[model samples]
Target: MTVRFFNFTDGQNVKLTAERGGYSVIEYQSDMSVNPYEAQLAYFASKMNVRRRQLVCHLDRFPSHCVSMQAGAMQWMSGDVQPKTGIRGAGDFARKLVRGSVTGESAIKPEYEGTGIVTLEPTYKFILLEDVTDWNGGIIIEDGAYLSSDASLTHRAEMISRPSAAIAGGEGLFNLGLYGNGLVALESSVPREELIVADLYDDVIKIDGSLAIAWSPTLQFTVERTTKSLIGSAASGEGLVNVYRGTGRIMFAPVATGHVSSASTGA
Candidate 1:
């Protein structure tokens, strides 16, 4: 069948809008009647420079592909769509549980299939659509970056090779890894335009903090002192820093994300 969006707005109190991909973003316009306090807050927020929340919906047509999403992320599904846990047996469940524990992700993600539309629960964080193939077939993402992905892709948790990396880098012990070819959705602190990408050729890149959102799984991550000598490290005024070495690519959000919290936007 045909899909159409009517009277959709982009930016400036957007009520509804669709991107190039099979996804649509929705936002609530400020209205005094709904919640006067919130409306007033939103109005002043505009003045104070706070961003509005936006929600995303995945639209599927007949003979469409399946999508796997974070647990409890589905807001609603319509038409011939079906949901599955993608779990085969007890062994799979146990493995997923371990992965979830280490990666700090949901234990079980639901897969949606068939010819229908599925909308995810909205969040204040920015939504990013990326093709896994663009990252040389594999990508390791920071914890909680995952939102959804085409079912054809494989998901797992990858552990840091060195314990010191986990403890000193401030990036956690394990990260969510995605493989294969498919479209993936991510919840990012910053929008796509603000993101920076670095491609390495048997080289190294270092960051002062946990700013890299995702990186090629082929790269090695570790924590290192800014200078080789202790006196140099002290004089530099910077201590241990996260470093990515080897030939691969990395995507980073230069801005800090500590203050951002997840909040839902209705479909």
Candidate 2:
């Protein structure tokens, strides 16, 4: 297969091509060679925070984002050494979706191209460090976004806001939300095409469990117990679960419900 690249700086785009059957690596300028300990020092030196404009990398495939952690960047950026670990990536902070590809040095990743899949084409953007209102240790989100700590509550609330949607009941409990005009990223066990997205404005929808990845912040989330629980919830299939309310949208993967693993969170 042939590979190609387009370089853009300050809004200018430059196209570059790769040799047939060859691969190209994307990394920070000096990241590839810096010592892990030393890199960490530089990273911390850049204001004691992980984000450094001069140090981060601007790459294709998913807009411009920070490359690996300072140490990982050092290994991958420099000529020949493979990274020993994952970069302290900003994408991981928000459970941002990742494009399927061979990114880690230890394994071969899938290459994604020409497909407008959500995994590779997330609608989330970084909340500039300079403009943060409340710096939550986790993901950075905009005003109208709310992440789902537990699936049931988030999914139901999103449903209350929307109408006629279904999500996997088996995928475990975990999801992130974005609203207003910001970007959101999430990890997906299934590819974008396989995932389902239902938009609702003024209706309610219900499903067996929580598997939604995102919803609008306007929606409200809560927990509810099945009617059986009051008398004999054990007899009924449904149990105590999380709930949602209000209006917005929900994105989820019903196929992998309940089975979602933490290993895939920032994959």
Candidate 3:
């Protein structure tokens, strides 16, 4: 089967932003305003330096392979495509339900198979096409990062070992973990150009805020005082900090990034 996109070219309204083994990131440009009131606000939004482009991903499937994505993420599909819930049995459904409850992720991720092209919904946030095999077959991501992945990969919920760390680190108690081989799509608050990656080798890295978006599951994560002594910690103007110890890699946004708040403040 052949696939073609109209009004979309290499550097026109749609552009190929990133690609890996299994998926590709397609950036589409469109006017952010739909009505007259929004048009006026869009002018101000542009002046304020707000981003307007939307990010979507295109997945190519083979006859024997499939693609799995977050529930309700499919915008459209073409060619001979069949979709399923990826539930093998009752035990698998139960496990997925529990994992979804703990990690705040969708339990029934939809899977598309057969030779086809699948398009995901558009979003203002940036898209990351990551190869899970690079992280030794497992990676832990922050809440809401999971977008889509090759059907070969599996998802689960991982909990922080220490209650104090989960309470004070600002990373919550549970995170979504992806394992196995294949490419994964992530919706990131910050663009890939602004992400910082650090590879540690039997060392430790500390951050004062919840900036790390994804990290290797092999790394030990915890929260600890900035200094060993309470007096020193107070004098340093820092208290507890999120710490990652061991050999692994971490990717994080250097600055704060998230959805923009509505302009209407209910004045």
Tens digits of per-residue lDDT, candidate 1, 214-233, equal: 99999998878899987998
Prediction 2 TM-score vs. true: 0.36
TM-score for every candidate vs. truth? 0.86, 0.36, 0.86
Tell me the tens digit of each residue's lDDT in model 2 across 99-120. Answer: 1111111111122222121111
Worst 10 residues of 2 by lDDT: 148-157
* Weakest lDDT window of 10 consecutive positions for candidate 1: 55-64
Candidate 3 on 1-267: residue-level lDDT in tens?
576767644655466767666576765444443698788766665465344433233444432368888887787777778899899999999999999988988989989887667777766667787887888899999888888888878787888768675786566788999899777888776778889999999999998878888999989888788999989989999888888899999998888865544211112
How does residue 144 of candidate 2 score in lDDT?
A: 22
Estimate the Cα RMSD of every predicted model relative to the unseen true structure: 3.2, 17.3, 3.9
The Cα RMSD of model 2 versus the native structure comes to 17.3
TM-score: which is higher, 2 or 3? 3
Backbone clashes in model 1, listed as residue pairs? none
Question: Judged by lDDT relative to the true structure, which candidate is superior, 2 or 3?
Answer: 3
| Model 1: lDDT to the true structure | 0.76
Q: Tell me which residue pairs clash in candidate 3.
A: none
Clashes of each: 0, 35, 0
